[model samples]
Target chain A: MQRLDPLYPTCPIRNVIDRMSDKWSLLILSTLNQNGIMRYKELNSAIPDISQKMLSSTLKRLEADKLINRKMYPEIPPRVEYSLTNTGQKLMPAVGMMVDWALEYFDEITK
Target chain B: MQRLDPLYPTCPIRNVIDRMSDKWSLLILSTLNQNGIMRYKELNSAIPDISQKMLSSTLKRLEADKLINRKMYPEIPPRVEYSLTNTGQKLMPAVGMMVDWALEYFDEITK
Candidate 1:
């Protein structure tokens, strides 16, 4: 386990936690992890509540952060697919663990 | 790995993500995970920037969520120390992974 130096003004822990904790980003990453290589429409349908604007923006951010890769295929309509990068894949075990923990304590948390 | 049904509106994933994603809450949880039992002053000094109201409220929320246990000792000043519960301890590995990932990609993310 890494010792987080709390005194550091610009700690990477906070930056990474902030990104992972973003509800949409977390949900999106989890979704991508389960169903590999999702196009824009598939992603939108999978996460039904996300607005088109939000989905596009979030995807851009994730791609920028290198957590997900956006592949634009040269088709007549230009198909774009999104999937996790190696770094993103490495991060999912942690997410999976959190999901397990959440489900384990769901009743207590919701009560 | 839990299959998060994004279709499920009240998913535990979202609930957990929302709670964990709150910046102050994440920082506080990380601090408690690192420093074990901490009083209000210790916690305040550890995170440094959290306001009194925010710290008090965030701690209450975390305790209510069963993430941390707060013990108030009867003393001249009535000392209260905070530590993670079994569930919270269970969740720290995930947080630790996130910190590791963040540190690994700090320059890329910041650039």
Candidate 2:
């Protein structure tokens, strides 16, 4: 594969595309969108195939990107939950549309 | 990165996302979308940073996915052209919105 173009830094849309295209990000995003708030274990369980390491790192990346919220509570053992931020929530409809389009064309695409 | 799950075969949107996430495809599609029809050389020139091999393979993948059309004209030297198919065109407004969304969020996302 060609290395990322130097234009990456200057091109914002391409930057967004790169992030959204991270493979795991969309799956994790879609899961949170469908299930609302979830604990770390819940997110891990939602996608059984993802490795714990991948889940942890992707979660961090999403949190850093500010697409998802990672909230902590001070309780007996302490509680942490994950959910979409407002930006992440707003992004869902577009993602939903893309999912619809993908679903509609899946058979055609994979064959 | 984690190896893709066995679930990949069963997950259609994931598959769609995988294809779309190929790094070069979106850039190439956007180029074709804006410029209408492009010859191989034009496409190569349009994205100055891409290696020629990468462009050729991505074009083939797009054509195989039916997201773009590849046509050849017979002549002394022969000519080939590429453009989006109906499905690709349908997908681009979503991509455009994604670009807009990315542009809107770039400052926050990258820094």
RMSD of each: 4.8, 4.0
- Residues A1-111, candidate 2: write the lDDT tens digits: 122226766687677777777768888999999999999989888888889999999898888888999999999788899999987887787788788888888777666
Tell me the deviation in Å of residue B62 in model 1.
0.7
- Which 10 consecutive positions of candidate 1 chain A have the poorest summed lDDT? A1-10
Residue pairs in collision within model 2: none
User: Chain A TM-score for each candidate, in the given order?
Assistant: 0.89, 0.88
Give the Å error, residue B21, model 2.
1.5
Evaluate candidate 2 and give its CAPRI docking class based on DockQ.
acceptable
Show model 1 residue runs off by greater than 4 Å.
A1-10, B1-10
TM-score of 1: 0.86
Q: Residue B8 error for model 1, in Å? A: 3.3
Residues B18-111, model 1: lDDT tens digits: 6776668778988998888899999998877788999998999889888899999999889999999997888888778778878888766656
What's the lDDT for candidate 2? 0.83
* Model 1 lDDT at residue A52: 97
Please tell me which predicted candidate would have the highest DockQ against the true structure.
Answer: 2
